[model samples]
Target chain A: QQQVKQSPQSLIVQKGGISIINCAYENTAFDYFPWYQQFPGKGPALLIAIRPDVSEKKEGRFTISFNKSAKQFSLHIMDSQPGDSATYFCAARVYTGTASKLTFGTGTRLQVTL
Target chain B: SAVISQKPSRDICQRGTSLTIQCQVDSQVTMMFWYRQQPGQSLTLIATANQGSEATYESGFVIDKFPISRPNLTFSTLTVSNMSPEDSSIYLCSVASGTNSYEQYFGPGTRLTVT
Candidate 1:
């Protein structure tokens, strides 16, 4: 399996609105789901993350809703700002004996306008 | 989260030339990895850097093509040899730490444009 499918290759929203991005995985062994935010000419920064056991996690304006049985997770950005405009990626962690490997989603380009 | 830095933020290299990207972590990390992110594409892991040993490469990647060096826990390097135009891509270095080691942090990444 090892695939994390993401939807809405691009999104456009107004400032102060909510931006949502979804991702699904085929591998059940994925124990951790992480969301990353990347700006132009920059690395992907860890935005928020959730475990399979927890259904939801909130970090300030960023939240992650996870579905264990459905094998899906989503990132919700509340009060989306123009500064939040960037490419977002969803990743799943596969823990091998020696190290953990991460499988990334195709990525979503988000634009928040005033 | 660990602070990771990469050298040569962007480079334009000619065909048949090779380039080496360096990754440095602020603190000691348990694991380090090298990834390639093509234009408008997702990150594809090339190999894992094991301290004091040979790297474990993934399918579709070989040590000869992408040689890796992990002299210590806080540093690693990836060399793209005999490059072609298709080799143009952003190379990134990531590290995994913490007690459970579930989280991964990425570096700024070196953008390589082969012509």
Candidate 2:
């Protein structure tokens, strides 16, 4: 069972445009939502995250819009640049016992053109 | 956040052969996890490497197939036994940074190709 679902398998946007990727979770127990950015051969890097208490969180050019009622969240990149082109993943984590378990969504490949 | 390094960034092994991948973290962590990502697929949890105890395997994973060793808090090893072509994928090791944080830091994955 895919606990988290992400859309737009691939995306292409202009350099100055906004790139948006959406995700939804099935498990309501998930309290932590994080987004990761991965390059071709490197590990995924932490971008920005949000909890259910807040509806949005922004860091630099990246923004995360979350909706607790819909169990959905999104990553938005403003003034997209070519350097921002990479695969993005939305992940949810619910506190299990001593260790937490993460549920990841299928990745979205984002391409920003000049 | 802990910095993790994985050994043998990539390897190609024959069918029925086994390869052991090692993960080393800069700091001690309570939990270490092994994940597998097939070509163009999302990451799937293989097992949780527990310190001073047997590792906990996920539903589709088994101890014999993906044996894990967590002798200490800062180091762990995952062995893919009896590898087949179907076992070809990128294996990643991750750990949460702080007790109150929700972020996970991953190492550059080990790419295993079984022929």
Report model 1's TM-score to 2 decimal places: 0.98
As a whole number from 0 to 100, the lDDT of residue B85 in candidate 1 is: 96
Off by over 4 Å in 2: B98-101
Give DockQ per model, in order.
Answer: 0.71, 0.67
Candidate 1 on A1-114: residue-level lDDT in tens? 689999889999999999999999999989999999999889999999998989999999999999998898999999999999999999999888778889999999999999
> Over the stretch A13-57, how does candidate 2's per-residue lDDT look in tens digits?
999999999999888889899998988887788889999999999
**For candidate 1, what is the interface RMSD?**
1.7
Question: What 10-residue stretch in candidate 1 chain B is worst by lDDT?
Answer: B95-104
Off by over 4 Å in 1: B98-100
Residue pairs with backbone overlap in model 1: none
Candidate 2 per-residue C-alpha lDDT over B1-115 given as tens digits, one digit per residue, 9 for 90 to 100: 7899999899999999999999999998878889998877888999877788898888999999999999998999999999999999999999875444577899999999998
